[model samples]
Target: MRTLTELLTITKNGRGRLVLVSAEEFFRLKSRDRRAVQPAELSDAELDLIAKAGMPVECAALDAEMKGYAL
Candidate 1:
């Protein structure tokens, strides 16, 4: 995916689960851990996406990621 928004769309399509490696995404599997994090481990909103999404789950994840990032 070229952007975070696109990554989110993938998650929405995946029914709230996404494998993020080739793009900017909300990662269920950390590169270091090689372990899978449960959907319930995510924020309530992250777990709420429908298969046919009105918006991307990556948006919410990106927003959360931005909280700790600097320009």
Candidate 2:
């Protein structure tokens, strides 16, 4: 028998009970009810900044990674 660690999907039944299955089986069932995922777009100002900087300039005030940066 397969263990819980080996299972990728655990869904609740009608009585709210848990069900376990392999990733392959989960995807096969998910394909029938799949939806498209969309990405968020950057604003015109953000795009211009990226173009001018030749890359992304993340400031400490705006990003978590640069939180400890002096400037």
Number of the top-ranking candidate, with TM-score as the measure: 2
Clashing pairs in 2: none
Cα lDDT of model 1 by residue, 1-71, tens digit: 25553443345654857544433333533444666688768676666653336646757766766786788
Q: Best by lDDT, which number?
A: 2
Write down the TM-score for model 1. 0.20
Candidate 1 ranges beyond 4 A from true positions: 1-35, 50-71
Candidate 1 all-Cα RMSD? 19.1
lDDT tens digits by residue: candidate 2, 1-71 = 77534654444563535667777767777889956443346677866886787434644445776678998
Candidate 2: Cα lDDT at 48 = 83
For every candidate, C-alpha RMSD to the true structure in Å: 19.1, 12.7
